[model samples]
Target: MSGPVSSTPAALTAPPKSPKVAPAPPAPAAPTLRDSNNNNNNNNNNNNNVVIDGILSKLLGARQTADGSCARVQLTNRELLEVTRRAQQVFSEESMLLRVSPPLRVFGDLHGQFRDFLLLLDQTGLPPGTRFLFLGDYVDRGEQSLEVVTLLFALKVRFPTSVFLLRGNHEVQPVNRRYGFFQEVTSRYNLEIYARFGSAFAYMPVAAVVGEKIFCVHGGISPRLHNLDQIRDIPRPARVPKQGLLTDLLWADPHPAAENFTDNLERGGGVPGAFRFRPHMSRPPALYKRPRIFCRSTTTHYLLGA
Candidate 1:
């Protein structure tokens, strides 16, 4: 995928620093929207659209300044909950492994840098007009995880077919709790809302196949997965487990020097089986099939020589 994504440590590891300066002009105002819901799911579509629009405007219209940082104004608890709920409904219908065609923009870990996320959209054009496949890690590490994720969910709801989100290791609660997302959410809202975000994350697809040749994931390949069918067979609405296929898919790394699958000491050694590997040795032929595997981890585990 794009000629062996660079595995160099700084590639996806650092968030772009916001330039220190005055705020940029505000984005154009969107229509004021009413927050409403109904029992009939179909009837709620209009309300969902309105809610998402408001959320987007609030997030997209964030005050930008130099220092590469932007201001953050938290969304109401109800609005945040609605975004997660609608996003879950869309994600619930997708396969654990999405099959996507090309002419797409595949993004790596954003790590909650909302301004950079905005700049990417600004440069690449937004959804519907331009298709995007996000390799997760939408939250944690940076200051605006809430803004980043909320904007993502709003865009997903606004254009479900055009935006694809894969689950990353950080999307799960355990890692985020230890990182920064949990504190960010609980500091503003409460435990229940944070839990709802986790529930939605549970439904996120973990991997994708672009143009039927490029395999994209947040982490690296799994020995347990021999074929696309096995990946599809993975059940959703589930947490990223401590071990097994899903765990490997979300946390595994690649090592050019590895002789075989080995413990990933970088990720707290030996908890999940076979976390690092040499491509030719560890990958199943059925899954490899000359496909370029795209992996973006904070640790920079891009598998290039497969």
Candidate 2:
């Protein structure tokens, strides 16, 4: 028929076509060192989160003390150290002054009153739902100083943005060591744990501004303070100085009798002279030039849940 169908059959006549095969997808690129490191970091973070969750569960579920006393929650020094270290890392990134937007619930002087603190949270709601700015004095006074501090660190680590902690007078070693916190820590854990807590405390923000209108601090204004930059300039891992802007911020009390500032005779009359202000600081041209600022503070003398 067509030259006897050519010498070769039609199937074999098509120019010896190569077999149709899909090129294998390029071999997946090998993971780089960066990818491996990232994966490890993620895994470590996940493990830390699990540990924190366990600690929180233990704290929230523990029986409330009837006598209003601290019943230790059986956490080891290692666990405490881990929590403190993480808290330090979080605090180190924040400035001495924190600027926050409103719809915030400001609390002052928890004073180691874990039960009362819990009740307050229950009423106001927790993080993400309602933001909180704690105005220091977290430890000492109440019998549950350890519980209060540990819970706060756990919360700070878990909700770094939503919940903020400011440095209170009790947060300093010189103050806390004389108060009940040192006794509680030493009795339950050890001096090293107490020291670690001190280290973490040094990193706490000293003050906060909310809605850009209100200035909040554990104590009142300091005479040494001229502008907000002074607060911003204060370095981290800072121990409360003997006498200066930092000390005044943490220890100043309100005294209507005094005109500007007077020695805080109540606390041995060293530094942190008490502050007194009416509606505005009109005398200081520098302060008057700045935007209107309202101050809210829990005086050093006043202890919440006392």
Candidate 3:
């Protein structure tokens, strides 16, 4: 038999009260990229100096206004200094041998062709969209070394993972100090700024591998480089040296005409017996030989979106 029904009417029963959970504290907002350079601390203040996005709007605004005329980019001393520090922070976190992925655009030496870089940005997409591996030689030789390096550094700061910058022979102190980059920096600002650039260069990766299928560097393989780990072994925050594997990796060139040498000439310290690589070398270092290797002398190239 069914249980007996309540004697009272249904309206007389009290309703169950719902739990009073204070609406979850509105989900915390995402951290925004404030123009920390500016002292404006108000999170919601509509300050014009604020960097609304990851971009430096003031700087990017000037870039967006760039016409065909190759004009030198303008920046305040404070802005330049800030950029240096920010970029150094980004580069320092990277390894000596960058392990990158594929579908990249490679470039040769761009001796500060800022206008060309801009055009390439127009042709190919910018960072966060396209992955790029620059081979180095970003400074010296080009009239607008400051603009080029600054732009590259800024991009690296904004999109560290998407952008890869390898060290070239010219990135070293001796090469750039004389080949025009030093003079350019000193002319625009002072020796201090030039030295700051040196600090940034010290952290640039010398080599990169993409999808574990390709090897990339500013120059070519060094005799000392028996494996990818060997490249990672070299420490950074130092200038490229005069001898050894690191030197050869940045200095060695392909001899299209093999007739001039017997074997391994100046491969390391101009020593005849020192380790060397030959043009169209049938056998690469055993560890990394399986990957097809290609390199350029600069980060000044256009890259399409992957």
Candidate 4:
């Protein structure tokens, strides 16, 4: 306590002087993979080195025409058979009604127009990055029926989660035989190939849903399709079913004129199963078409296309 007591080593009693620490500098931004010459070369090499033996890979590597239309003959009979078998096997595993997510590119009635299909692929990106739900008629009435169907089957096999194929009227033997695909396959390959394709079609889904909003069908809706599960519960791997939800989905067309039509009698068209629905339709038609429907308490709905 005497002689100022050396101020009691002032630091010990006074608030301890905080260590003079310099604030940390801002951390550098995480490194990003900017495409560079070195990286591009590596990526190219990796892509080249990958060994794929499936039909999809064959289609990917197959030479397009000068106009980038139809694919040339890339598969042998053996390869085509194997691919068709794979298609039947894979499609069989899918539900009668598919449930795909948003971010899809849906198309209607390719009709064996391999060139247009190729053009579409060129315009829009293919999947798993960009998924697709083709609404049938994959074969018939085009120069490249085999090419189109084979490529589709290959795609479905290659990216099962990313590609979905629905059934159209032309998918059945009765239609395709009279149209073009049946004769085309028979003339080009054989009846065996044609038959195999029919098998694949039998397993195809009649419709698909996108999110909880959209319903995708090739033709139109059925009265029985009032509930979603009705579509889901229809047993698949059977021939285009005779006069039911399945038949209506494949054969019917939209009677857009009528909101809630109940066509009990045919007007001379007399097509036994040909029916229509006031409310019908798909997931994606690209970014071009989006359906905005307004529902009222009266059960009538209005679709405002934007």
Candidate 5:
């Protein structure tokens, strides 16, 4: 349900390095879904079918009510380019990646906790030369989503590489509309800036590889994702589009069982149509197929092998 949390293993320890501005490579082309033997089963076949049917049906119906609304509202390439340029200007290249000595700090689900976030920064001693990779969910569900975004934007501006921002489910469109982000933006800034920032989120990378060993993301792994490349091939939206691809990522819960190639059912005990996981667990024991492990500090449930 939450992002992956790991201990700072001694073997994986490395010092932070100064940020380097490598030339941004051309964005990878979006992957096309072809009929593959791996997904020949009724369940796997239904996944793509459900996505297409839902998107097409929604677009077809929305076309009648609004003329070119989707086209007009969608983020343009020019807008995205401008945001990136501004971001580059605000944050120095070196700020993007910091070389912390050993024992990295991992934080989860800030959910716009501005004061608490500040406390975390103070406690962790983040800014000067430490690397902090935030696993999404930065906004929403808190009173100060705007402050949280502003602070993060400032941090990114100050230390881009040191503070890595990954895309979270809440960062997408429909969820923002329902949650506090859109309203917070409109109230704090103007609708124009709100829309602009929304567009910028599309450019945010979905996953980050820390030290080439640990993988970090806002949400858990999906059935659609097998190898890391499969995740990379997913289209990055400039703005949250209808049918909620980004939303699915933010909300999708990961289970250890789903990671097993042998396990057919999803973490939520469903047929895996459109990758929906069940919302509730009948009992805590029935929830996970494996043993539950607890951290000495927090009692929240997490997969042992995960």
Candidate 6:
């Protein structure tokens, strides 16, 4: 079913220009702990300092004011470090807490439903010390794609380590253009950030292995993918082609059959292979009585019964 895709002019408006904010004061050097000789501690202390400096660089690099009226502060390095440290502490403490309660409230197809998305947060509770994996499809087909993306981006900034976002079929450019995400991004953030976020989406993981058992993805299984390792070996480009290795995986459908199959139907037919499919069972009574015969061909098995 189609639904309204919200677009707010304000969400796309450029930030107002204001006076440059002063940079924060430098941090005090970490104190060195050394033995009586005090010879080796200097190197260790320097290494630690270098690591801290690297983190500070990332924080400072990401800092930039959007405009004058915007009170929202992009994270600074100091803030990022603090957030990371806090997240680490929380993880250490609550590593086992979620196991006893729930499997982390998995969600699917949040196509930029910003309002409902927030409601979901209120309903499911934020991913403070726990885990939540969104099965992709975060953008497109909704008005609040910008808000949705920015909100998730902000969450990534805040929680960093705890929040997980995977790439869905809609994440690809062509599909996104046909869907609503491309328009939502261009309308809201202009093409620049849209491109940036698109690039970000490319790097996003395609699937997630949850709790070591269930495999979650936006789409289904493909004949090309016989096992999970094959999928992992596939080189994911920064963006997917219209149809190819990545596209097939993100768009393929799974079947219920025990083995792969082939039929008179073309290569891309709905029931191309012997894989399990829920739709095949919905045929006419006659077909059910003389159901398709199962045969193993050179390349794949076939379901045959005219």
In candidate 1, list every pair of residues with a backbone clash: 18-67, 18-68, 18-69, 19-66, 19-67, 19-68, 20-66, 20-67
Q: For model 3, what is the C-alpha lDDT against the true structure?
A: 0.60
* Candidate 1 lDDT tens digits, 74-148: 788889889999999989988998888877788889988888887766556554556788998999899889888
lDDT to native, each model: 0.74, 0.67, 0.60, 0.61, 0.44, 0.45
lDDT (tens digit, per residue) of candidate 5 on 184-300? 767655677677667666666665544443444565434444344444455544343322434334445543343232232343312233243332222122113322331111112
Task: Give the CA lDDT, 0 to 100, for residue 247 in model 6.
Answer: 56
By lDDT, the best candidate is 1
**Largest TM-score belongs to which candidate?**
1
Clashes per candidate, residues 3 or more apart or on different chains:
8, 0, 3, 0, 14, 13
Which residue ranges in model 5 land beyond 4 Å of their true spot?
1-85, 88-103, 238-249, 255-306
Better structure of 2 and 5 per TM-score: 2
**Candidate 6 local lDDT, 127-197, one digit each (tens):** 44344666677888876565565556545433444465667777777678777877865654466555656
Question: For residues 167-245, what per-residue lDDT tens digits would candidate 4 score against the true structure?
Answer: 8878888888887887888787888888888888888888776665565677665655556667667776666655676
CA displacement after TM-score superposition, residue 87 of candidate 5 (Å): 3.4
lDDT of 2 at 120: 61
**True lDDT of residue 114, candidate 1:** 83
User: Ten-residue segment with the worst summed lDDT in candidate 4?
Assistant: 24-33
Better of 4 and 5 by TM-score: 4
**Tens-digit per-residue lDDT, 40-104, candidate 3:** 33544334222223234332332222243464556667667766776777678778888887666
User: What CA RMSD would you report for each candidate?
Assistant: 7.2, 21.0, 17.8, 20.6, 18.4, 15.4
Clashes of 2: 0
RMSD, candidate 1, Å: 7.2
Write down the worst ten-residue block by lDDT for model 5.
63-72
Model 3 pairs in collision:
108-298, 136-298, 266-270
Q: Per-prediction TM-score, please?
A: 0.83, 0.78, 0.72, 0.69, 0.53, 0.52
Q: Which ten residues in a row have the lowest lDDT in candidate 3?
A: 23-32
